[model samples]
Target: MTLRNSDFDEIRVWDNENFVHPWEGMEHIGQNERTFTETADGIYVTTEAGKRLIDGPAGMWCVQIGYGNGEIADAMATQARDMAYFSPFNNANSVPARLAHEIAKRTPGDLNHVFFTTGGSTAVDTAIRFVHFRNNILGRPEKKIVISRQKAYHGSTFLAASVSGKERDKGWLDQAQGMSYFLPNVNPYIRPEGMSLQAFLDEKVADLENAILEIGADKVAAFIAEPILASGGVIVPPKGYHKRCLDICRKYDVLYISDEVVTGWGRLGHWFASEDVFDIVPDIITTAKGLTSGYVPMGACIISDALIDSVSGEKSQGATFSNGYTYSGHPVSAIAALKNIEIFEREGILEHVREVSPLFQERLTALGDFPIVGDTRGMGLVGCVECVVDSNSEDSLDLDKTVGARIDHHCQELGLILRPIINMCVFSPPLIINVSQINQMFDIMEKGIKLTTEDLAVKGLWSA
Candidate 1:
């Protein structure tokens, strides 16, 4: 059936009245404007008016295999038709079982157990809960505090949000107080002005060790970290950071939870970036977004065999973790994940990412030459372009707030969509993006920045 203009208008009205979007503010509740995306395929989404734009953010950094893959769609349909819904709590299913094996074999170390969830938030929530559960099982109920870093984006669930260190997001929302401790920011770009990178690294590592020692390691349950802080403007920590942090965690017997929600499943040229890219096998790795390439909602908390064995087998009789979601290991999502893995292998997408990432990073680094771009950093397919204003002005934060959106607006007009986070424009294009498309994307981004710089100067908000 064809949708008429009136139908679209009615849909928009209904959306305004009924739909409460994620991260919606109170003032923008009923009068918010939004793009009506009509269709999408192959790294491009078509608007309602038939304008096709490159999905620069890759659908919130999830669309690894890109938009509208026939294989994934067929797998979802077949799984739905074969056996869609069943209680995973009391029963086991083949799709999830096979998918679990697929994930287990790819993950580093002995992280062989998989617990599925609906999405990233629930995955992180499950990981945190399990950490607490493990401590409780070991009779150390005081070991309930989680250590995280400033500006890290974990998830939106209660426990996950509690552990997340994005300060601005917590201003109006309530989180589990006193349950999480945050360290300083890890963005190397923000380190002290004359400090050597090695010294900066030492300071960051020292911060973790100090926190563990000061808090008394027995009270700290886990240190949750993103191999690369994705939502915190793609912040890449110093070299050997993860390995050093892992060492500190091991020294203090604190469990390490790697939040690879954005870095996994070929986004970093591997099925998992913990071992391959970051060189540390975490005790628990929470993954989503690219698990099914955002075809269907699914996430996982992959736990190490050692951690699970510590709690099982006669340690305490009749004890249960007793935590799960309704859609844990849903058949459709599991099958989709399996199919995603299959395509990654069959098409050599991981190899492609590794091969083309140099070009991606080169273009991203070149953006730093632009006066408005203060920093550009990334690895694999993910990247960020951060804009800076005159630091001397009191309105610096206010000026920075609109820089990204203004660049995004210009990029949209130029047929590219950006994920603007305050002063940063992040990019995680489809892993299948080619040389031509990469050039096109950065070309448009350059133009967008140019146009935005001109606009900012005209408005007297900033000048570089």
Candidate 2:
């Protein structure tokens, strides 16, 4: 008879069958028992079966500073040994508080207050709620509609998904977000034949103005956007996009919320993309992922002085304002973030981004001649290759949904771990990567493209 251990006796078979995944991860769940992962190269991931896979997606774009840092680990252990947990209800740890001060010094504009969250999604939820409370405090309770561009991926939470620009994200969502007034984020591919990118952006701003009026400008509380639109196929905004956005937000008294959860850190070849590229001061900025470089989970919603002043004014903000997680401003996470920044500085991560960015563009764009490859675009370490059914028709590939997934699986078989977001195969390697590593990473991807294309052709997917 088999020995029935106490733990095993209570633990029965785990039923994960038929679990509907929130993202595009449902394709993998139906397979045999999941294979565990263990190691990571400078820009790759390894499975439990000893398959060496290039980490093309940078672990969902979080590990911007690469993986396996001894300093980050040490910092976490030291902080844990010193003080593990302290409730921020009244008492709090000095490490996170001081870290908050340091972060404020680094954020754009007069964003003097830093509110911590577990990740980007929660940080987004916090920013929206905070802005709503501020508007209510000012007696402009009617200002409630939060505007986001179409196809934006804010987060997966109920509130976050409600304000998100994606329709699919709202599939399982219930009820409206108590707000609407969404706008376009300037998709150049959709612009008129004669319209320039700048002109198209101008039209978008005009549309925003028109929408604000239609929604009753008083009903619009904030205008939220990503730095360059990370998840929405890495949509790169036209010149003067953020400037005009800031102008419109200021024009209608709508608060500016910049979701830099993917654009922050050295991913954009700068400390903060807002100042580094766009030159706009947002009222709120949400960041995560690279905060600790995936060594641990941590995020921040940096707040401006104007919003803080309104909420903590001569009286309460009227809204109970009782929203936030228990793990907010986690000490261990904060320490890890500090160490990550230190490593970033020591390694000169931003310089590395500046150096290899041009090379990355050259290599990725060279593959544009491939039959299915449509557009290759991105800035700094974050990029994407939008494989379409046919570039001439400009019609997106339906295979990108399934065949492209097979391509990713084929890549995994070749020891390349990459995540496909919507219609593009994204690339966000650790910032510490060298040029040789970048070449090899893309080489593996190019090979996967050829193999996947051949496989698709054999299955009658290719048509003249």
* Clash count for each candidate, listed in order shown: 0, 4
Residue-level lDDT of model 2, residues 53-152, one tens digit each, is 7677788788876667777778899999988777876677888898898788788889989889999889999998898777777788789888888878
Q: What are the runs in model 1 whose C-alpha is more than 4 Å off?
A: none
Query: Using TM-score as the measure, which candidate wins?
Result: 1
lDDT (CA) per prediction: 0.93, 0.78
The alpha-carbon lDDT assigned to residue 92 of candidate 1 equals: 91
Candidate 1 colliding pairs: none
Where is model 2 more than 4 Å wrong at Cα?
1-35, 315-320, 390-398
* Angstrom error at residue 84, model 1: 0.9
TM-score of each: 0.98, 0.91
Candidate 1 C-alpha RMSD relative to the actual structure = 1.0
CA lDDT of 143 in candidate 2? Answer: 90
